[model samples]
Target chain A: MPDAGPPGRRPRAAPAGRAASLRRQLFFWLLPVAGVALFVSALADYLVARDAASQAHDQGLLDAATTYAERVQLSPQGVPRDMPAVAQRMLLAEPDDRVFFRLVDANGIVAAGGAGLPDDLPDGSAEAPAFFDLGEGQQRLRGVAMRFEAGGRPFRLAVATTTRKRDRLMAEVLLGMAVPEALVFMMTGLLLAFGIRRGLAPIAPLRREIARRSHSDLDPLDMAPVPEEIRPVVAEINDLFARLDRALRAQRDFVADAAHQLRTPVAGLLAQVEAAERAAAARPLGAAELAGVAATARRLSRLVAQLLALARAEPGAPLPMEDLDLAEVVREGAEEWLPRAFAHDVDIQFDLARTPLTGSRIALREMLANLVDNAMRHGGPGGRIRIGCHPADGEARIVVEDAGPGIAPGDRERVLERFCRLPGAHPDGSGLGLAIVRAVVARHGGDIRLGESALGGLAVDIRLPAPAP
Target chain B: MRDARLLLIEDDQALADGLSRSLRQDGCQVAAAVTAAEAKALVGSRAFDVIVLDLGLPDGDGREVLAHLQQLGKDTPVLVLSARDGLDERVGLLDLGADDYVVKPAAVDEIRARVRAMLRRRRARTGQTVTLGRLTLDPQARRAYVDAEPLTLTARELAALEFLAARADRIVTKDDLLAGLYGGDRDVSENAVEKLISRIRARVEPAGVQLRVVRGLGYYLQTGDA
Candidate 1:
């Protein structure tokens, strides 16, 4: 069994600072609001309870004043009589407070009961009474004063009580409102904390899934279980993984193809060398045999150079690019091939225009060399080859045409693949020329087309995207 | 080139042995070095007609040897022999004072031709005549002679003969011939070059100078019997 090699090192996630917890954040935010609600409700309850307690106590004081007024028989000078002792005891019967009463004639003098009551009572009518508060500290009182006519004479009655009962009732009301509200506020906080944790629970499994995955695992994450809000993010990551998978596969395929291509020429060269050695042991090798060895070695060298060019031209390969004229590249490439063209008696012509573009000079040169080489190989001896470069429609167009048997439309596409040599092709041909041209075109964001040339041969038309003006 | 001295710096033992043997057969005295240290020592101690320096060496990069050559102020033409086929590396080596750059796995014939071309260019600068076997060309005076006898030739014929003689024992293509003859002028057809080559062949063939045509390729000039 083949080893899968060492497991891919786990990707180290970015270092995280002390992150804020969503649950804690929610709880902290709700605490102050809950507390404010409890305080406001307690204050309202205290206000309402105090009002009711004071109203009831004042009513008792008014009743006691009215009773004293009714029971009193006015003397000839119209002085009011004190209340009866049993009546007084009944009026003062508050367990949590002390009560007092007084009677006064029209002259504003106290005539009975407690003499220390305030004489500054508001004016009162026989049918209506007035309420007032008097004194300070332990002697503080809520009082009611009333005026009445007995035996056709007028008098004023006053009653007062301490505030202890009102205060005690208010305290009970405040505690009644605050305790339950506080309990409910605390319960709400606990529920909020629980809800926040539950809402964020799905994220943990997602993180664990990612952390546990190997680098080679480029499969997409399951989006069905992902939260709807985070689904788009996961989908984006899946898209990235798909792209990476494709690039990795392409690289692996290229490496394999290059190795396979290299093997054939190297083996041939080695065989030729061995044969030459065996022959040389018997006699000096003839020039023909020596030429055969040299040709094999040259073929191997050409293959190696082509493989390097293809690797450099592969898409996504990093290249140092510069602004250069396509015409210059075409000229240099044509010059390099002029010797071979002359050797074949091929009339090679170039009509170069200053087509400006941003590209790797080496890659462009290699691309041109391959195109010209392909033309020379197929164009045959005593044929013509035309190379042209021009700028058109915001692109740099380069065309290489040869005068030979042009490729059929159906077979043109296949020839661009690595090692796809056409039947009856030259034995020395490596079949990587068109593939390299395609890769270089693809790398430069360019398009290549094959068509029948007017010169009665195959024409390669390439258009590369130009740099923006 | 029979008396020319060459220094070959390469790490691969088999390749060095084979290349040195081929060069020696070509009548060049070759000194082989397997490391940069040896190469530097040889370059400093002896004056060579040409240095074939490999970029990859066991002791250090071949550029160190190039730097050493420059430090010694030696004007001997240095030809870079490397496995790197990248244009940038070739341009960089040339910029570093290398006279020529040839990718490895090249034929010994091509290497010899490049070395000859480099030496020819050097000799041309010194106004020396180029000789290939029985044929010798005085390029400065635009004249050719077969065994001390001046050959009557037209100016274009002499230029063509000089071009072929300068690159003797190598292929010369029609386009190269036309470009060499006329520079960037394309008005001259390839038929004209063929006619010119045939005429020159007829004129020089009687003097032991053979102008051979490699069908579907180019022409080759041979000075002596093959």
Candidate 2:
């Protein structure tokens, strides 16, 4: 109704592919969060498992060192010796680890076993055993060292073992903890998908409802059990249906009226022809006897043309725009109505300047033709009419002013409506000219202003925006 | 078939039947085709004086026929009949070599006039001059002379007079005169055409040529000898 102005600038009613579109949005928003949660939980599990394994491995190493120190014995010359192998094996009981033990006396002599071992053992007192990690290239070992009395001499003993079992325990913990979390994550993802699908379940029914309807069935869509989020959308669609129903109804009524309008003249034509044939038996038929038929036929032709022009001028179905000089369009108007004005005893004066308009040539022609016709109709006998197109504020200004009885300012708007004629106006008009003109001007997104002309009748001024350079 | 053979290509049966009946009553053979295919077959079968083509044919648009006619180099005058009142459609059809177009619910007389006009124009295009009484109209020269005396008339008077003279003894509707002179796109009224005829009539009536007015139909130019 508002000239379908800036068709491309209109906002979309709703986003397309609604359900899949929402899923895509949710996936982008939520997947990263779910992934981070999985990573954090897995990291916590690995850290706890590694800490517990290190503590347990260190405690076992200390116990093995203490037991070796306790079983020391003098070997005839008071050299400290380890306890029996079977007793040492009983104390160092670890299935997946290799154990080492060494006892060093204050004289720097190995009394037990220190063969091929690193010499960086921590010096310790009897009160506390020092547990430390020893690096053997890439492989790591945990060791415990303590000072103890052996064969009535103070000696330092250290026991060490590789961390292969501790690492295996941590790997077991990582897998054991992550599997359930991952399963839960997958379950949550599936549930989310199910929930989204369930939320959008109404779409299929809506589609089916729409598809099942006949073309003429313009009833509002059923909103039963529609999701709350989509209520506004369905309501909007229903509103559109209501508007369409009204428009169609109005169109049907108009067609009925137009049909009647057409029948009047056509019936008159047939009757006149029949009468003329009848008159052939009496007196010869001529223009005087067939005046009604001729007049109606001509009226019918103009009415048909006007009706078609009105239909063409509707803004809903827009014509493609083209760049043309406004001066050319004005000349077309002049060409159409100059003779008409002359016949009406009106003086048509043209004050021309070059102005550019980007519009459908036919539509602008219709608009200007109407303006000229309106002037010729209401410009009174012997009135002077002035028409022009000039540039103003980067817009094309087209105007028609006539020296006749102009309408009061209040009635200017009413005159533009369809079938609206002023009291005591000429009967020759179909009252559609201005309506078609307004429709065309509206479609072009141009402005129409009706005011008092300097020539004393009506001044119809139109301004259309200039196209891009 | 009569000498003036007309082919009507219209999808609407009622309108087609009515138009064909009226045209047939007017002493012309009217061939009514209900579809584009039928119309196409009918057109190629024999030459028609004029083709009243409806653009909204069931099988296809009538423009196809226009294209087909052009391709075949058949200069048969086509008068497009359409419910579409769009100027672009009318202009586009005319540009496609259609002689003219008439929007429907058109009066029977209007269609008859258009057919006659198209046929006349077609004849005129073949370099023919028309004679009514002693007044002879040379279309090529665009001149009119009454019994060897060249009449002094404006360009518009000559146009109106030429249209009337071509259909002498037959009625020419005022609407037809308006169309013939000013064309279909203009806003000139019937009064304008009437005024032109009277002015031309003032000069030609004394030259033994008589243009009789039928109020509903229009002027019938009768030769003094007739």
Candidate 3:
């Protein structure tokens, strides 16, 4: 299996809270829009209401002035005759409302009797009647002022009404417009929140469904019910699962096939032992004859043992993982096989590095054992064997070389296959030693290469990945 | 003369008969059973001096016999013979009270040697020092005396010598020695082992005991005149 990118250093996830998040985005864009619209509408509503109230009050004042102008027979001075009667007629008309009027000669004088009017009016200026409150809290009055040129003299007229009436009308107009707008804004915000949450609801179920799955189940989730926007993510998940399931199935089959194939030879060895036993029992055995039967038994026994060892070294073998000291394992393995090398007059040299391997110690040791055994077995008698380990390519490297007759370049890969032995090899071997070495190395995810050694024999180099952080 | 009754439990008939003949020639009364069930029945019916048990049977595992014998507290020595040489399998058989174990494809003589060793261990009631030729060893005392002189040896060396002496004159391979000594892990180096042997030889060979190295095979301990 390939190493997944260094675990536990995964990237942090982004925020997934949709409502508050969406509201924040909307607030930035919509708050300014809502504020500008509210400001413009409020200004327009105030202007229209104020202008209409002033215009209606001005019309009443003008009518009163026209009546007075007609009543006056324009006595040589152009002063009003019966001014009090005319004022009384205008002010007390219909209701007992207040009204004030003043007629001025060519000189600038007080034209209107409305409260808070300036004493001196600017010459040649046209000022329309305007409204304002007169008192503080209670008894406040709303009134209007009007200026006109009547009988060729500067004159002004003013009218007054209590603010309670004007305020009631203005309040009704604003409430009618503002209240509905506020209600619609609140309702729209609520609906937006609900819709956003509903849209993201499927993600939680998808996460839960994924979390509930067994490790062996890599089937893709059904995307038919999901939102259209999420279909791509779902499809990708299913594709990954499909690939993972296929890989796991292939690995399982490889293991099963290897186990079944290796058992047959062992069964055959058992049968042969029984046959040899009967052969010895049926007749008196001579020295050479007895030796032949015993040697055959020994050969069969060796073959069966090697077969099991080779199977154990296969990538399919269930190797338990642990932290192992490479130096210790190499030193120990070399020491264990020292006697056999000496018996064959071969000098075995060791130069091991102090590195750690994160893998199965048994499988690693078995791999090394097979390599050393192969070197001694194929390397002619009295040849020197050298073993060493060091760090290479972010992994640990193990090398075993011998001075015996090296393998041909063409035969290097073939020797790694099961039951493939070199011609003129030792008669006692099962031809599975190198094959076992290859299998063990493969199981560790390590690569092994065979080539000419410094000792003029075969050199086996193995490399395994470094321990995980 | 004591009749050494040996119970042979092998599933294969041809192998059982051949093994029985070899045992009989060695003056053992061979009681052959083809399965663990038959062996269990025969064991209940008669008393044998030693048992040669095979692991794989059509009916059940040979370890069952060992578990059964252990439960019954029967001390009759048992020598395990199986075709499976897996490290775990060997440890399991021995741990289950089998006195000895030998993987299959074994010579008749090696099997006989293992049977004799089982019988010898059983016959030696006191578990005292055993002197064969010039080599003297006391397994219980954890010491070795070569040619009447005391010698200091490592624990592994002493165990190795004991194993070699117990089955002398037979060719034991490196794998066999490894299985016997270090059953836990087989990663021991050959050179380091050779050093231990050389050390062992330096101490013992100074006297008269000879430990000869068999080329391309294993070491043999020769006690008599070279």
Candidate 4:
């Protein structure tokens, strides 16, 4: 009965078009992280080296300011006596820089340099030479202003220079340190990308292996060359394929069995029709002969119909589930089969309680219909068939009893297989009736038991579990 | 387009043979293909009025052929024959451009009627009417009249009359009427169709159309004047 998959469930196989590519995923995540790390460390290196380089340049400016102030000979009135251009030239040794120096008395009047500089420059505290950055944008400058005892008056000597050299040195240090690491980082990036691709090379064959397979190929994949990490997934996939294969084989077997079961009836119907045709050709067919041919044809029709029901109710086939009353299904089935029962001269009774169960309505009805058909066929003439349904202790129960010849106790289970019939069973039985009933019962997670009927014949009892609320 | 041409795509040789023979009897020219490749080749090479397809083909799932047909933008009707009792496959195949579907182990008469119905739809003409004797029925409008007097009937009763009237004077079997009345894949019992015919027969009796039963064969619809 588990041929179509457990009613309403098929094993979950990973779907197509979602093939996971580890190479691309790894590269996408790794490259950005590496780039960010390189940029951060390079920025840190640039900041530290630039601070060291700025200190050396500020010290050089301080030395030049001190030497230049020493050369200024000021009279006792705190005014410069002589301003030599050679001393200033010696101080401004680097000609690329625009340098300015100012010696001013405590009154803050520039004595020997340009007065365009701000007048509110802080009188640095009397300790060591003070260094500060003046005006940062388009002409960046660093200034060191100090107070020196010249001409017995506290004379403030200030030296300012454009930071052209320091800026160049900062770039040099950053480029010197960061460029090599950036190159190495890029190389490592390339290596990592290549490694990822090489690491995922096994998947190409795995994909090709799966792709190259025929649609019906259900064999397990060869595990030899699979990567260790992906082998487990392959194993799981192969296992899923194995389970699906079993279900498929069971379905194929059911079809094959169905076909084999139909072969005899089809051949019989064909032979009967052909014989009738030949007999009619020779002499007009008699009523008795026509009746015989019609009887076979009708049986053939019944067999095919029952076979279809059996396949539909296949225990493994996943028909959808719905909330339905077992009592209602029984009532409907009784109504549907009432005419057939009448033709077979059987009286049927209904004792239905409002029993609810979760199952495929079609499957359940087919089960009940098969039971009724079997009862009608085997119950013989002037027999009574009793049908009952009720909920008992969380399970729904269905019982059909007839006053015909009951199956022997040992033969009960054997009669549930396809094309099985008791030795003295009704000649018209296709043997698919009980088989379909068993399949349907199994699919609904129910149990079917055969017992002696209180009606002096066979009693078929079934119990199906009610779905959770 | 002169006559209905059908392509029967089935892996089961016996079913293919049986169905093709029966369809030919119903005045159709059937071309049988036993594999997916063969079916695809035939479908590509020739235009069929209707294609009877089985989903469980040996070479591949028949849905591939359905996709191929769709990709080619051919609107030829396809009726999928499937052994799968699953509802998903049925709904999926239908959604994938199969016009209709039938579960396997189907009656041959039912398959033929489905093909016939599909072909009729392909050649549909609006406002067409059918008349036999005093009985005139417009199937599209679901209306019937007798000698210029209107006859009111239920949907099922009118449908049964339309099917029988289409094959007038010919013996249409019970299975034929069942297939034609409820469609190919509907799981209706023979008793229902029998009861429906009796009810229609009563309604049509006074309309001058006779629904006669031939024992062991089926009912024959003809004019009472005949």
By lDDT, the better pick of 2 and 3 is 2
lDDT of 1 at A234: 89
lDDT of 3 by residue, A1-469 (tens): 5543342443335656533564457555665666567668776977798778656654655556555544544456654443555655764364434444444445554332334433443222234344444554435544444455556665544444444445565677777768776776666566656665676777778867876666776877988777888889889989999988887886676456555644655455556556657767987645765565556556666665666666666545666676777766775454345546655766677776677888766566667777888888878687778888887767988889988788899999998887676898876666677877888778778888999898889999888887853
List model 2 lDDT by residue over A1-469, tens digit each: 2243343445554767664587667766676677788889778877877888888777777676766676667788888756546334844455677666777888888877775457877888888888878876336777788899866778888877777777787778878888988887887777767777777777778866766665557899878767778889989988998988887786787687778778877898898888888987898787776787668778888888877777776746768677888876776445335434544567677777778878888788878888788888887778787878888897888888888799899999999987778898888887778888888888888889999999888999988887755
Q: Kindly provide the TM-score of model 4 when superposed on the true structure, using C-alpha atoms.
A: 0.57
The ten-residue window of minimal lDDT in model 4 chain A covers A2-11
TM-score of 2: 0.67
For model 4, residues A61-144, the per-residue Cα lDDT tens digits are 877877777777876765786453644575546667777667777776777675445665656644777887778764777888
Q: Could you say which candidate leads in DockQ?
A: 1
Q: If both were scored by lDDT, which would come out higher, candidate 3 or candidate 4?
A: 4
Clashing pairs in 1: A342-B173, A342-B174, A342-B175, A343-B173, A343-B217, A343-B218
Estimate, for each residue in A1-469, the C-alpha lDDT of model 1 and write its tens digit.
2433443454445534446755577778977887787778777877877788888877777777776666676556555455546445656676777777777765665666756675567766767787888878767888887787677656667777788777677777777877888788888788878887888788888878877776678899988889997899889999999998998788888788888988987888788888889999999988877787778778887888888888888876678778999987766554355656666777777777789999988899889889888988898898888888889999999998999899999999999998789999988899999999999999999999999999999999999999976
Count of clashes, each model: 6, 6, 18, 8
Question: C-alpha displacement of B17 in model 2, angstroms?
Answer: 13
RMSD of each: 8.3, 10.0, 12.0, 13.8
> Once superposed on the true structure, which residue ranges of model 1 sit more than 4 Å away at CA?
A1-9, A18-197, A210-215, A270-290, B85-91, B130-226
- Superposed by TM-score, candidate 3 places the C-alpha of residue A68 at a distance from the truth, in angstroms, of 14
Worst 10 residues of 1 chain B by lDDT: B217-226
Model 3, range B1-226, lDDT digits (tens) per residue?
Answer: 0368888999888788888887888788888888788888888878888999998988999988898888777888888887766656655777898877776666676677667656654644335455545657888988888777777888999887776666544445566677777773558877666776778777777665556664434565543321
TM-score of 3: 0.49
| TM-scores of all predicted structures | 0.69, 0.67, 0.49, 0.57
